[model samples]
Target chain A: MIVWLILGAAVMGFLRRVDLYDAFSEGAKEGLKSAVRIIPGLAAILTALRILQASGLMEALQRLLVPLAEALGLPGGAAPLLLIRPLSGSASLAVLEDILKRFGPDSVTGLAASAMMGSGETVLYTCAVYLSAAGIRRTRYVIPVSLAGWLAGCAVVGLFFR
Target chain B: MSAALFLMIVCGVIYAACTGRIAAVEQAVLEAGQEAARTAWRLAGGFAFFGGVIGILEKAGAVRGLVRMIRRPLRALFGRDTGQEALEAISLNLSANMLGLGNAATPMGMRAARLLSAEGGGQPSAALCLLLVINATSVQLMPTGVIALRSAAGSAMPAAILWPSLIASAASTGVGVLLCKLLERGGR
Candidate 1:
């Protein structure tokens, strides 16, 4: 997929009499800079998340969210996945696997969990990385809006599989 | 974000201290920093490759072609006049996301975010928020990763999730976009 995109862009650049080499190098320079600039923010997010996970705070948070998950029409078992989904993709995947193992894959809880996992992005991580990369400190409703969307997706999973 | 970071660390330390998991938390912090570095390295390659391709497209005037194609819908969605380059970046990112090209998507999306934020005078504009909302809502046409995982786990119907996933993501994206539009107006 990416190979084709590159080929197409190259062909277009050639046809348009553009300096592909220079353009690519110039753009890549900026891209690298952006990547480097976000390392500090990324470290902070990762450390916070890891600490939360290792300290069992995430588990405690999950326990706290169980009633809310049930209220949202998801299984209480899905609370852990829901709580961790926005913070870490790999952690959420681990939770999904646990769900599939504990509840058979075809069961309501497993199916609902899988459906939710399959549908959403890591909201908090994405927002943090993007905003930090842009040097924008104040998110200004981005977090609330993105989390709302994530919750909406989770809610739809209950309604869809029900 | 500063507040969030502060709270996360402080809460984590207190929790660890209370639970006698201080050593685990310390290890996690040290490991997390290394993991973050590794992740940044992996992402830098994607950013450079995709950014280079986009740069070539921009130079070739193909970005202009792209902007013209999606201009009307995007204009209505963003409700503002943004530059052609910015629109092109936005479309590229969204397309990459829809295609489930995550490695490609992040770099493009970040580029688009940077451009849109720059246009908004370093604040996240409505367009920027909409971009993020759409991304977070999962607009992928295919959930290949889930299907593969299901198949690996010996599921009878690994692909059964395709439609449900699509529908759920679509519903969320719709709601997200609507809220962004409403909030944009409300903010003004």
Candidate 2:
């Protein structure tokens, strides 16, 4: 995939008479800089997520949300992922890893978990970072809308997995 | 976000304390940052590689052509246009996301957000909201990472989830787009 993207871009660059090497280096520099800039926020997010998971908060919530999950047609085992997938990418991936570990990846539970991971986003995390980058506050209607979208995706996953 | 973080930490610690699982809390506090650091490095590596490719694409006018190709459908979807730069950024970001290059998509998405924010007079417009919503509910064409995870976990058919993922993601973005458009019209 990476090879195809580069080759395609390089061919396009050649056709357009652009200096591909120079452009590539420039972008790489910016990428490194962005990486540096995002570290703190990412750390905070990850740390908080780990705490949430470790504290049994997620476990408790899972129990609480199981009925809701079933009502929405999701497997009870999928409760944790369905909740977290939209909150943090890495966190949910960790949850997915755990699910795959416990349930066997080919199990119905695992497929449902994978589908949830595949479909959703790190909604709150993405908005916080992007809005912070733009120095904008008062995130109006974004969280609700995205979460609604996430629920829609979850429902679809439930339909198939069940 | 800070408040949410603070609450999670405090509540988590208290919960752990109450449940005699304080050790887990300590471990989480000590280790999560390292995990984040490692992930940041991975993301940076990807960004560096894809950024170079995207840089080449941008300078090549390829991004422009790509934007022109999608502007009609996008504008029809969002009901507005910001400008060429913003459009290019969004197109590149969306394309990268669709191609499952999330690391590449972030920088491009941020570029689009920066542009849209600048133009929105401090209050993010409906278009900007739609952008964020669409991004959050990204429609995946390929989900390589999940497949890889499934393979690693010994799934006999790792690719079985592919079509399901595509349908779910596509349906998600579709609903998200419609909700944003409705809200946008209502806001106006």
Winning model by DockQ: 2
List, residue by residue over B87-149, the lDDT tens digit for candidate 2.
Answer: 888898888889888888888887778888876776786777888898889766988889999
Candidate 2 scores a C-alpha RMSD against the true structure in Å of: 2.3
lDDT score, candidate 2, position B74: 72
Where's the lowest-lDDT run of ten residues in candidate 2 chain B? B73-82
- Residue clash pairs of candidate 1: none
lDDT of 1 by residue, B1-188 (tens): 66777887899889999999999998998999899899889888877877788789888987778778888998888766877767887888888788887766777777788888876665688888888888877889998887777777777887877887788788888888888888888884
Error of 1 at A54 (Å): 0.9
Once fitted onto the true fold, the runs of candidate 2 whose alpha carbons sit more than 4 angstroms away are B1-7, B20-27, B30-35
Interface Cα RMSD of candidate 2: 2.3
The reply for model 1, stretches above 4 Å from the true place, is: A18-20, B119-122
Model 1 chain A is weakest, by summed lDDT over 10 consecutive residues, at A132-141
Q: Count the backbone clashes (under 3 Å) in each candidate.
A: 0, 0
